[model samples]
Target: MSPRPPRRLPLGTATSIGAAVLAFTAITVAGLGSFGAFSGLTSARLAMLAAPEAVEVEATLARVGITAETLAAAGCSSGDATNVGADALAHLDTTNWNALVSADGDVRDAQAEVDRLGKLVRAGQADQEDLTAYATAKSTLATETSTRDGLLDALYDAAVADLTSGETTLLETMHGNSDRPVPLQYTVSDRTDAQWTSLRNALANIKTSGMCGEDPDTACTTLVTNCNAETEVATAASNLDSNLAGVTSALHTALGQE
Candidate 1:
């Protein structure tokens, strides 16, 4: 007998098998397309994420260069005396001697006594000894006033000298830092900026006699602000290599290939 013709699959079974195969093929193709599309979208997102950071990095680098150049142009040298007069004025010691009291009341009382004695002398209501005593007291008061003023002046001068030296030191350090490698420049900038901030705080906190006002010298303030700005730039510039590397890594991961 002829080999029973190969038993045919049931019609329903054959149709079901064919439908499953076609569905699997379509799913595979669609999956591949979806993967490609997802990759492109991820790449675009990574680019978007990196763009702002890239711009910030470039701007910071440029700022670092400009700040270094500015520091160089600032004539940074030790022993700079640019603000001597202003500093001296700022540090003036305006001690009120009249408010001070010894065993004999305040200086104002002493002055008042002198004035009273003089009035008595002028009115002839005082004798020769009283007149002599009044003149001596007046002379002594004048001498003490002169001495107090001299001491205050000396103190003011010393304070101003200290300020000048401090400023000079900062300038010299800034100059040295300016010519360093970019990263080291950032490091030094951070340090010096801190120092500048300390100095500014000290100066700003100074309780002056209000003769020159309570504000710090403009030059010192400007230096501090500029230094701080440079430090900000350095904060960005110093991280540039790492930032770019991170961006690259993120992009690689997004693309599903390194």
Candidate 2:
């Protein structure tokens, strides 16, 4: 018959062993013991330390409102759809075109009415007062139409200026041509790679040991094996904390915080 499986430890003993494993792992990886406050940390306690940095990074990114996915589709390097203000130009153009059509229609109707009234006056069929009234209405419509055209022109000019400004800003930002902040995509990718690498290194360096003496009893061997499994848990927690720190650093760089 096969040998009997090692009996599992009591729940309390198992909990203690798991805690010990994680505490030691944190000490080994973060060297937090030297930091005084972290000298007595529990499992993954250092993870919370990245929170304030994360908040600060998010605050800095709030100004642009750009995301990694947006940057990808925007083709910042190729200048495709990068001018965020260009859409306003199309909207202004459509509005100006509609206004011009409506104004032209109004002027044409008024002119036709004035011509009809003038003919009637010439034939002595209508009073000069009616002809004068229609002519004055046409002149008023023409003046209003001119004013509308001027306003539309001004709006179009403003929209073009905005588009130009946005393009300039994008170009400068992408090229790091000035003090303008770098785009999020360009800065975050490398930092993300570095973060994963750091986590991998941390996990690789996770050393495990068992306090077993020669002629150790079955219980001691079983306890050591189970506690060794806790290294996986500890590394997972470390990975989470590392991820938080990495993201915070990436966002800081994107914000030009460094």
Candidate 3:
């Protein structure tokens, strides 16, 4: 069997900084929680196909649950005050279990959303690269048309000026032609260009919004999971591995791997 062309990977989401201007903005990225916006013939199959992403989401959700528990226990009360300073420790309690639930819901929803997006991709609804290319092509076409038109208009004006001039140069005879080339032989269809740009831009916007299907959910969950696991495992194993030497040292070291 011949080798097939390597498939292109999905474009990852851009990191949107929560800046002064975009503080209230919700920045979602495709592959958020990595569930990949569930869409396909079978939800199970879609999930299976995207299992890597799902595992990622699962790990994240579990971690988020842990963090919520941690914060709640640590007594970080929540409110607008969390935005304050050293005193913000009180806000830790503010994160409701519902917040964790909501995060879970987002992670779960990503599977469905990504599947939907995938189906759309298959059906040719909104392709990111296609939209990008379309926009580029439209821009190029517009610029080229304008430049070509300008050149042609200059050609026209120059042709007229040269032909009408008193200079004895019969430029037409040099090319062995009887008449001059037609100047201003160009076309500019505003409707066509506008339509193309509008379509491309619409697709670009769709592509941009759909980009963050489950990535955020996945990221939050993963951070919680890994950090919590690290904390717990370290706390537990450290007690077990006390004063390692010859025979026990290797076993203790292997336990550290866990």
Candidate 4:
């Protein structure tokens, strides 16, 4: 047989092949476009997923900042004498207290920045720059918050220690002079029943008074009042001891024993 002409595709076959190749090209382009869109969507979803954590962190920092500030302020009031007295030994001042102030301001500023970035992230508008800035601010706020808390605790502890020592000293002084007799202008039996009853009631009230709770301002006020009362009690006891010593001295002189 004569050399067979190269087997050729039919016209229909050629047309069909061309159409199949075009369809494949279109499908591939469409698939690539879909994949790009899916990738963008996934990135956006990841950012949204991270936003709640940012919000929570910011809130926690804010709470800690407020608590530290409140405690520090409570520990150092200008109006409360006990707070002032305790802080005198602790030497707490605006300089030390201002550490919390600075930290609080920093944390608030950082929280605001994080909130802004978190909103952008949730809206799929955040870029890498926003994410980086948010992370940096969060880290800085954490460090500052920790430092602020430490300072607050230290100052509070110092104040407590000073106040406790002062209270103890007053108690010891009162106890030491408890046996001393109060000087009387007349015989005990000559005193009015009402006067004795009032004295007993005053002592009972002082003994039964309760310390303030929860409210820092109230606590400070209570502490001051109690401390003053304790001081007065101690002073009264000391005066009774002095008076008894004077009486003993006068009696010894009268008897010519000295």
Question: Whose TM-score is greatest here?
Answer: 4
Model 4 Cα lDDT, one tens digit per residue, 1-258: 111111122344335433543454455455656566545443222222221221222222222221112222222122222342334223344455345445545656766877888898889898999888878877876776566556545543443343344333332232222223322211112224554454445434444554433333444455435533554444444444444344334323322334
Candidate 2 lands at a TM-score of 0.25
> What local lDDT score does residue 28 receive in model 2, on the 0 to 100 scale?
57
TM-score of 1: 0.24
Name model 4 segments beyond 4 Å from true: 1-85, 88-90, 163-258
- Candidates in order, TM-scores: namely 0.24, 0.25, 0.18, 0.31
List ranges where model 3 is wrong by over 4 Å: 1-95, 123-238, 242-258
In model 4, what are the clashing residue pairs, if there are any?
A: none
Question: Candidate 3's residue-wise lDDT over 1-258, tens digit each?
Answer: 122111111122101111211222112222333554533233222222211221222222122121112222222223211211112122212232223223323434544555555565668886787556555555554544444334323322322231222111221111111111211001001124554344345444444556956233444445334433554334323322332222132222222211
Could you give candidate 1's per-residue lDDT for residues 100-128 as a string of tens digits? 11211233455687898999988989998
Clashing pairs in 1: none
lDDT string, candidate 2, 1-258, tens digits? 122111222344335434544454565556655677656765444432322222222321122222223223223321222222232233334344345334534655666777787778778887767877867877876775565545434433332243344433432242231112322223222224444454334333332222332354455455434433554334333433434344334434443344
Kindly give the number of clashing pairs for every candidate: 0, 0, 37, 0
Q: Which 10 residues in a row give candidate 3 its minimum summed lDDT?
A: 182-191
Where model 2 places Cα greater than 4 Å from the true spot, the runs are: 1-88, 93-100, 121-126, 162-258
- True-vs-predicted CA distance for residue 28, candidate 3, Å: 34
